[model samples]
Target: MPQNKAAIATQDAPAAIGPYSQAVRSGDLLFTSGQVGFDPASGALVSGGVEAEARQVLKNLAAVVGAAGLQMTDVVKTTVFLADMNDFAAVNAIYAEAFAGAEVMPARSTVQVARLPRDARVEIEAVARFA
Candidate 1:
Protein backbone atom coordinates (compact mmCIF):
# COMPACT_ATOMS: atom_id res chain seq x y z
CA MET A 1 0.00 0.00 0.00
CA PRO A 2 1.11 3.53 -0.64
CA GLN A 3 1.88 5.76 2.29
CA ASN A 4 -0.37 8.68 3.14
CA LYS A 5 2.45 11.18 3.30
CA ALA A 6 3.53 14.38 1.65
CA ALA A 7 6.84 16.23 1.59
CA ILE A 8 6.77 19.79 2.90
CA ALA A 9 9.16 22.51 1.83
CA THR A 10 9.54 26.27 2.01
CA GLN A 11 12.20 28.76 0.91
CA ASP A 12 11.85 30.49 4.26
CA ALA A 13 13.80 27.61 5.77
CA PRO A 14 17.19 26.22 4.84
CA ALA A 15 17.21 23.55 2.24
CA ALA A 16 18.16 20.04 3.19
CA ILE A 17 21.81 19.28 2.65
CA GLY A 18 21.23 15.60 2.10
CA PRO A 19 18.50 13.24 1.00
CA TYR A 20 15.58 14.44 3.01
CA SER A 21 12.67 16.78 2.83
CA GLN A 22 12.40 19.75 5.13
CA ALA A 23 9.36 18.06 6.64
CA VAL A 24 6.87 15.34 5.95
CA ARG A 25 3.18 15.22 6.77
CA SER A 26 1.29 12.03 7.45
CA GLY A 27 -2.28 12.09 8.59
CA ASP A 28 -2.58 14.90 11.13
CA LEU A 29 1.06 14.95 12.12
CA LEU A 30 3.94 16.85 10.60
CA PHE A 31 7.52 15.73 11.21
CA THR A 32 10.29 18.20 10.56
CA SER A 33 13.86 17.32 9.81
CA GLY A 34 16.58 18.70 12.03
CA GLN A 35 17.19 22.44 11.61
CA VAL A 36 20.47 24.14 12.37
CA GLY A 37 21.37 27.83 12.49
CA PHE A 38 22.06 28.10 8.78
CA ASP A 39 20.50 31.15 7.17
CA PRO A 40 18.23 30.01 4.34
CA ALA A 41 19.41 32.52 1.80
CA SER A 42 23.14 32.26 2.38
CA GLY A 43 23.28 28.67 3.62
CA ALA A 44 25.81 29.71 6.22
CA LEU A 45 25.67 28.96 9.92
CA VAL A 46 24.65 32.05 11.82
CA SER A 47 27.58 33.65 13.62
CA GLY A 48 27.13 33.34 17.34
CA GLY A 49 27.19 30.92 20.22
CA VAL A 50 24.59 28.35 21.17
CA GLU A 51 22.05 30.99 22.14
CA ALA A 52 22.02 32.59 18.72
CA GLU A 53 22.11 29.24 17.00
CA ALA A 54 19.22 28.01 19.11
CA ARG A 55 17.14 31.04 18.21
CA GLN A 56 17.73 30.52 14.50
CA VAL A 57 17.00 26.84 14.89
CA LEU A 58 13.60 27.60 16.35
CA LYS A 59 12.88 30.04 13.59
CA ASN A 60 13.76 27.44 10.97
CA LEU A 61 11.58 24.86 12.63
CA ALA A 62 8.75 27.37 12.88
CA ALA A 63 9.04 28.05 9.18
CA VAL A 64 8.60 24.37 8.46
CA VAL A 65 5.67 24.15 10.87
CA GLY A 66 4.00 27.10 9.21
CA ALA A 67 4.52 25.52 5.83
CA ALA A 68 2.47 22.62 7.05
CA GLY A 69 -0.35 24.94 8.07
CA LEU A 70 0.39 24.48 11.74
CA GLN A 71 1.50 26.78 14.51
CA MET A 72 4.14 26.45 17.18
CA THR A 73 1.35 25.52 19.59
CA ASP A 74 0.70 22.50 17.45
CA VAL A 75 4.16 21.13 18.12
CA VAL A 76 3.81 18.02 20.22
CA LYS A 77 7.43 17.00 20.60
CA THR A 78 10.97 18.09 19.85
CA THR A 79 14.46 16.64 19.91
CA VAL A 80 17.36 18.99 20.46
CA PHE A 81 20.97 18.08 19.74
CA LEU A 82 23.78 20.15 21.11
CA ALA A 83 27.46 19.94 20.37
CA ASP A 84 28.24 20.87 23.95
CA MET A 85 26.15 20.01 26.97
CA ASN A 86 27.42 23.11 28.72
CA ASP A 87 25.37 25.24 26.37
CA PHE A 88 22.18 23.61 27.54
CA ALA A 89 21.19 26.49 29.73
CA ALA A 90 21.65 29.01 26.98
CA VAL A 91 19.80 26.95 24.44
CA ASN A 92 17.05 26.18 26.94
CA ALA A 93 16.53 29.85 27.66
CA ILE A 94 16.09 30.68 23.99
CA TYR A 95 13.88 27.66 23.51
CA ALA A 96 11.55 28.74 26.29
CA GLU A 97 11.06 32.13 24.72
CA ALA A 98 10.38 30.64 21.30
CA PHE A 99 7.44 28.58 22.44
CA ALA A 100 6.13 31.05 24.95
CA GLY A 101 2.37 31.75 24.83
CA ALA A 102 1.64 28.41 23.30
CA GLU A 103 -1.45 26.62 24.53
CA VAL A 104 0.67 23.62 25.52
CA MET A 105 4.41 23.30 25.45
CA PRO A 106 5.77 20.38 23.53
CA ALA A 107 7.67 17.52 25.14
CA ARG A 108 11.39 17.62 24.42
CA SER A 109 14.56 15.58 24.59
CA THR A 110 17.98 17.21 24.57
CA VAL A 111 21.33 15.56 24.28
CA GLN A 112 24.89 16.48 23.51
CA VAL A 113 26.35 14.95 20.41
CA ALA A 114 29.93 14.57 19.25
CA ARG A 115 29.31 17.09 16.51
CA LEU A 116 26.75 18.30 14.02
CA PRO A 117 26.54 19.06 10.33
CA ARG A 118 28.66 22.10 9.44
CA ASP A 119 29.80 22.11 13.06
CA ALA A 120 26.59 23.72 14.23
CA ARG A 121 26.43 24.33 17.93
CA VAL A 122 22.81 23.23 18.04
CA GLU A 123 20.15 21.60 15.94
CA ILE A 124 16.42 21.06 16.54
CA GLU A 125 13.65 19.00 15.04
CA ALA A 126 9.96 18.92 15.86
CA VAL A 127 6.75 16.99 15.49
CA ALA A 128 3.52 18.91 15.16
CA ARG A 129 -0.14 17.96 15.09
CA PHE A 130 -2.72 19.55 12.84
CA ALA A 131 -6.24 20.28 13.96
Candidate 2:
Protein backbone atom coordinates (compact mmCIF):
# COMPACT_ATOMS: atom_id res chain seq x y z
CA MET A 1 0.00 0.00 0.00
CA PRO A 2 3.07 2.20 0.22
CA GLN A 3 3.65 2.39 -3.52
CA ASN A 4 5.28 -0.96 -4.04
CA LYS A 5 5.54 -2.91 -7.28
CA ALA A 6 3.06 -5.56 -6.13
CA ALA A 7 0.46 -3.66 -4.13
CA ILE A 8 -1.56 -0.86 -5.67
CA ALA A 9 -3.24 1.90 -3.69
CA THR A 10 -4.48 5.44 -4.23
CA GLN A 11 -6.06 8.20 -2.22
CA ASP A 12 -8.62 8.53 -4.96
CA ALA A 13 -10.15 5.29 -3.79
CA PRO A 14 -11.50 4.29 -0.44
CA ALA A 15 -9.02 2.46 1.77
CA ALA A 16 -9.53 -1.22 2.15
CA ILE A 17 -11.39 -2.00 5.35
CA GLY A 18 -9.85 -5.43 5.63
CA PRO A 19 -6.46 -7.04 5.46
CA TYR A 20 -5.89 -6.62 1.80
CA SER A 21 -4.60 -4.13 -0.73
CA GLN A 22 -6.97 -2.45 -3.16
CA ALA A 23 -5.36 -4.37 -5.94
CA VAL A 24 -2.27 -6.52 -6.42
CA ARG A 25 -0.18 -6.80 -9.51
CA SER A 26 0.85 -10.24 -10.68
CA GLY A 27 2.91 -10.17 -13.81
CA ASP A 28 0.86 -8.46 -16.53
CA LEU A 29 -2.40 -8.76 -14.63
CA LEU A 30 -3.62 -6.68 -11.76
CA PHE A 31 -6.13 -8.46 -9.49
CA THR A 32 -8.39 -6.09 -7.63
CA SER A 33 -10.29 -6.59 -4.43
CA GLY A 34 -14.06 -6.16 -4.58
CA GLN A 35 -15.20 -2.55 -4.30
CA VAL A 36 -18.44 -1.34 -2.74
CA GLY A 37 -20.36 1.91 -2.84
CA PHE A 38 -18.56 3.57 0.00
CA ASP A 39 -17.36 7.08 -0.78
CA PRO A 40 -13.61 7.57 -0.50
CA ALA A 41 -14.10 10.94 1.14
CA SER A 42 -16.63 10.05 3.85
CA GLY A 43 -15.91 6.34 3.96
CA ALA A 44 -19.66 5.78 4.00
CA LEU A 45 -21.85 3.89 1.57
CA VAL A 46 -23.53 6.21 -0.90
CA SER A 47 -27.23 6.80 -0.66
CA GLY A 48 -29.78 5.98 -3.38
CA GLY A 49 -30.54 2.52 -4.79
CA VAL A 50 -28.63 -0.24 -6.49
CA GLU A 51 -28.08 1.87 -9.58
CA ALA A 52 -26.25 4.53 -7.61
CA GLU A 53 -24.32 1.97 -5.62
CA ALA A 54 -23.30 0.12 -8.76
CA ARG A 55 -22.00 3.34 -10.28
CA GLN A 56 -19.93 4.04 -7.20
CA VAL A 57 -18.60 0.49 -7.28
CA LEU A 58 -17.41 0.97 -10.84
CA LYS A 59 -15.94 4.33 -9.93
CA ASN A 60 -14.01 2.64 -7.16
CA LEU A 61 -12.76 -0.01 -9.58
CA ALA A 62 -11.64 2.71 -11.97
CA ALA A 63 -9.66 4.26 -9.17
CA VAL A 64 -7.89 0.99 -8.47
CA VAL A 65 -7.18 0.37 -12.13
CA GLY A 66 -5.99 3.95 -12.53
CA ALA A 67 -3.64 3.46 -9.63
CA ALA A 68 -2.17 0.58 -11.61
CA GLY A 69 -1.66 3.02 -14.49
CA LEU A 70 -4.57 1.60 -16.41
CA GLN A 71 -8.14 2.55 -17.23
CA MET A 72 -11.48 0.78 -17.16
CA THR A 73 -10.92 -0.05 -20.81
CA ASP A 74 -7.92 -2.07 -19.75
CA VAL A 75 -10.01 -4.29 -17.54
CA VAL A 76 -10.13 -7.73 -19.09
CA LYS A 77 -12.62 -9.33 -16.75
CA THR A 78 -14.85 -8.62 -13.81
CA THR A 79 -16.87 -10.57 -11.25
CA VAL A 80 -19.89 -8.76 -9.96
CA PHE A 81 -21.56 -9.66 -6.68
CA LEU A 82 -25.12 -8.65 -6.15
CA ALA A 83 -27.44 -8.85 -3.22
CA ASP A 84 -30.38 -9.24 -5.57
CA MET A 85 -30.58 -10.76 -8.99
CA ASN A 86 -33.32 -8.35 -9.93
CA ASP A 87 -30.78 -5.58 -9.84
CA PHE A 88 -28.76 -7.10 -12.67
CA ALA A 89 -30.20 -4.93 -15.42
CA ALA A 90 -29.67 -1.83 -13.36
CA VAL A 91 -26.09 -2.62 -12.48
CA ASN A 92 -25.30 -3.81 -15.98
CA ALA A 93 -26.41 -0.54 -17.46
CA ILE A 94 -24.12 1.38 -15.14
CA TYR A 95 -21.34 -1.12 -15.77
CA ALA A 96 -21.66 -0.56 -19.50
CA GLU A 97 -21.32 3.17 -19.08
CA ALA A 98 -17.95 2.81 -17.43
CA PHE A 99 -16.48 0.66 -20.18
CA ALA A 100 -18.07 2.39 -23.14
CA GLY A 101 -14.70 3.51 -24.47
CA ALA A 102 -13.28 0.01 -24.50
CA GLU A 103 -12.86 -1.43 -27.98
CA VAL A 104 -14.08 -4.67 -26.47
CA MET A 105 -16.01 -4.84 -23.28
CA PRO A 106 -14.48 -6.76 -20.43
CA ALA A 107 -15.80 -10.25 -19.76
CA ARG A 108 -18.03 -10.23 -16.72
CA SER A 109 -20.08 -12.39 -14.38
CA THR A 110 -22.81 -11.34 -12.02
CA VAL A 111 -24.14 -13.47 -9.22
CA GLN A 112 -26.50 -12.84 -6.38
CA VAL A 113 -25.00 -13.35 -2.97
CA ALA A 114 -26.77 -13.85 0.30
CA ARG A 115 -25.18 -10.71 1.58
CA LEU A 116 -22.36 -8.27 0.96
CA PRO A 117 -20.02 -6.25 3.07
CA ARG A 118 -21.65 -3.11 4.45
CA ASP A 119 -24.94 -4.59 3.24
CA ALA A 120 -24.27 -3.05 -0.10
CA ARG A 121 -26.65 -3.87 -2.93
CA VAL A 122 -23.78 -4.46 -5.28
CA GLU A 123 -20.04 -5.11 -5.27
CA ILE A 124 -17.52 -5.51 -8.05
CA GLU A 125 -13.96 -6.73 -8.54
CA ALA A 126 -11.84 -6.61 -11.64
CA VAL A 127 -8.76 -7.89 -13.41
CA ALA A 128 -6.84 -5.48 -15.58
CA ARG A 129 -4.15 -6.06 -18.15
CA PHE A 130 -1.02 -3.94 -18.41
CA ALA A 131 -1.30 -3.74 -22.16
Candidate 3:
Protein backbone atom coordinates (compact mmCIF):
# COMPACT_ATOMS: atom_id res chain seq x y z
CA MET A 1 0.00 0.00 0.00
CA PRO A 2 1.15 3.55 -0.75
CA GLN A 3 1.63 6.06 2.03
CA ASN A 4 -0.31 9.29 2.28
CA LYS A 5 1.69 12.36 1.37
CA ALA A 6 1.01 15.94 2.35
CA ALA A 7 -0.03 18.18 -0.51
CA ILE A 8 1.47 21.65 -0.66
CA ALA A 9 -0.69 24.73 -0.21
CA THR A 10 -0.67 27.65 -2.62
CA GLN A 11 -0.96 31.40 -2.21
CA ASP A 12 -3.48 31.40 -5.00
CA ALA A 13 -5.95 29.99 -2.51
CA PRO A 14 -6.90 31.18 0.94
CA ALA A 15 -4.75 29.62 3.62
CA ALA A 16 -6.31 26.97 5.80
CA ILE A 17 -8.03 28.67 8.73
CA GLY A 18 -7.07 25.89 11.08
CA PRO A 19 -4.58 23.13 11.56
CA TYR A 20 -4.93 21.43 8.22
CA SER A 21 -3.18 21.33 4.92
CA GLN A 22 -5.15 22.45 1.90
CA ALA A 23 -4.82 19.02 0.37
CA VAL A 24 -2.92 15.80 0.74
CA ARG A 25 -1.56 13.52 -1.99
CA SER A 26 -1.03 9.84 -1.49
CA GLY A 27 0.30 7.84 -4.38
CA ASP A 28 -1.68 9.29 -7.27
CA LEU A 29 -4.65 10.48 -5.31
CA LEU A 30 -5.13 13.95 -3.84
CA PHE A 31 -7.77 14.87 -1.31
CA THR A 32 -8.60 18.49 -0.58
CA SER A 33 -9.92 19.90 2.62
CA GLY A 34 -13.17 21.81 2.40
CA GLN A 35 -12.69 25.37 1.20
CA VAL A 36 -15.05 28.17 1.98
CA GLY A 37 -15.78 31.51 0.30
CA PHE A 38 -12.75 33.30 1.65
CA ASP A 39 -10.74 35.28 -0.85
CA PRO A 40 -7.02 34.61 -0.85
CA ALA A 41 -6.03 38.23 -1.11
CA SER A 42 -7.74 39.27 2.10
CA GLY A 43 -8.27 35.86 3.68
CA ALA A 44 -11.82 36.85 4.42
CA LEU A 45 -15.14 35.71 3.13
CA VAL A 46 -15.95 37.30 -0.18
CA SER A 47 -18.89 39.59 0.23
CA GLY A 48 -21.69 37.86 -1.66
CA GLY A 49 -24.62 35.57 -1.57
CA VAL A 50 -24.72 31.86 -2.27
CA GLU A 51 -23.99 32.19 -5.98
CA ALA A 52 -20.91 34.31 -5.50
CA GLU A 53 -19.77 32.29 -2.53
CA ALA A 54 -20.06 29.10 -4.52
CA ARG A 55 -17.88 30.53 -7.27
CA GLN A 56 -15.20 31.48 -4.76
CA VAL A 57 -15.28 27.98 -3.32
CA LEU A 58 -14.61 26.51 -6.75
CA LYS A 59 -11.88 29.01 -7.41
CA ASN A 60 -10.20 28.01 -4.17
CA LEU A 61 -10.52 24.34 -5.04
CA ALA A 62 -8.99 25.00 -8.44
CA ALA A 63 -6.05 26.71 -6.80
CA VAL A 64 -5.41 23.81 -4.43
CA VAL A 65 -5.64 21.30 -7.26
CA GLY A 66 -3.20 23.35 -9.30
CA ALA A 67 -0.78 23.49 -6.39
CA ALA A 68 -0.70 19.70 -6.41
CA GLY A 69 0.75 19.87 -9.93
CA LEU A 70 -2.59 18.86 -11.37
CA GLN A 71 -5.23 20.61 -13.37
CA MET A 72 -8.92 20.77 -12.72
CA THR A 73 -9.31 18.03 -15.34
CA ASP A 74 -7.62 15.63 -12.97
CA VAL A 75 -10.44 15.77 -10.51
CA VAL A 76 -12.51 12.57 -10.25
CA LYS A 77 -14.83 13.30 -7.37
CA THR A 78 -16.18 16.11 -5.18
CA THR A 79 -18.28 16.85 -2.14
CA VAL A 80 -20.21 20.07 -1.76
CA PHE A 81 -21.70 21.49 1.41
CA LEU A 82 -24.33 24.17 1.32
CA ALA A 83 -26.03 26.05 4.07
CA ASP A 84 -29.31 25.63 2.26
CA MET A 85 -30.54 23.28 -0.43
CA ASN A 86 -32.38 26.15 -2.11
CA ASP A 87 -29.09 27.16 -3.66
CA PHE A 88 -28.54 23.75 -5.22
CA ALA A 89 -29.53 24.66 -8.76
CA ALA A 90 -27.52 27.84 -8.78
CA VAL A 91 -24.48 26.11 -7.36
CA ASN A 92 -24.81 23.25 -9.83
CA ALA A 93 -24.94 25.62 -12.76
CA ILE A 94 -21.75 27.38 -11.70
CA TYR A 95 -20.04 24.10 -10.93
CA ALA A 96 -20.93 22.73 -14.36
CA GLU A 97 -19.48 25.77 -16.07
CA ALA A 98 -16.29 25.48 -14.06
CA PHE A 99 -15.78 21.84 -14.98
CA ALA A 100 -17.16 22.21 -18.47
CA GLY A 101 -13.88 21.42 -20.12
CA ALA A 102 -12.51 19.04 -17.52
CA GLU A 103 -11.15 15.88 -19.10
CA VAL A 104 -12.74 13.80 -16.39
CA MET A 105 -16.19 14.83 -15.32
CA PRO A 106 -16.10 13.96 -11.64
CA ALA A 107 -18.76 12.16 -9.68
CA ARG A 108 -20.16 14.44 -6.96
CA SER A 109 -22.29 14.56 -3.87
CA THR A 110 -23.74 17.71 -2.32
CA VAL A 111 -25.27 18.05 1.08
CA GLN A 112 -27.16 20.70 2.96
CA VAL A 113 -25.60 21.55 6.27
CA ALA A 114 -26.74 23.53 9.28
CA ARG A 115 -23.63 25.68 9.29
CA LEU A 116 -20.09 25.99 8.08
CA PRO A 117 -16.98 27.81 9.13
CA ARG A 118 -17.20 31.58 8.74
CA ASP A 119 -20.93 31.14 8.31
CA ALA A 120 -20.32 31.05 4.60
CA ARG A 121 -22.99 29.78 2.26
CA VAL A 122 -20.88 27.19 0.50
CA GLU A 123 -17.90 24.95 1.01
CA ILE A 124 -16.39 22.49 -1.46
CA GLU A 125 -13.76 19.79 -1.45
CA ALA A 126 -12.46 17.50 -4.16
CA VAL A 127 -10.45 14.38 -4.89
CA ALA A 128 -8.14 14.19 -7.88
CA ARG A 129 -6.03 11.51 -9.43
CA PHE A 130 -2.63 12.25 -10.88
CA ALA A 131 -2.11 10.64 -14.25
Model 1, range 28-55, lDDT digits (tens) per residue?
Answer: 8999999999999999999977777888
**Which scores higher on lDDT, 1 or 2?**
1
lDDT of 2 by residue, 1-131 (tens): 56535999998889999899999998899999999999999999999999889889889999999999999999999999999999998888898899999999999888999999989999999999997
For candidate 3, report its TM-score. 0.94
Q: State the lDDT at 83 in candidate 1.
A: 95
List model 3 lDDT by residue over 18-118, tens digit each: 89999999888999999898999999899868888988999999999999999888999999999999999999999998899986689999999999998
Q: Rank the candidates by TM-score, best first.
A: 1, 2, 3
Ranking by lDDT: 1, 2, 3
Which of the two candidates, 1 or 3, achieves a greater lDDT against the reference? 1
lDDT winner among the candidates? 1
Candidate 2 scores a C-alpha RMSD against the true structure in Å of 2.9
After the best TM-score superposition of candidate 3, give how far the Cα of residue 127 lies from its true spot, in angstroms: 0.3
Candidate 2 lowest-lDDT run of ten = 1-10
lDDT of each: 0.94, 0.92, 0.91
Candidate 1: regions farther than 4 A off: none
Off by over 4 Å in 2: 1-5
**TM-score, cand. 2:** 0.95
Q: Give the winner by TM-score.
A: 1
Q: What RMSD value applies to candidate 1?
A: 0.7
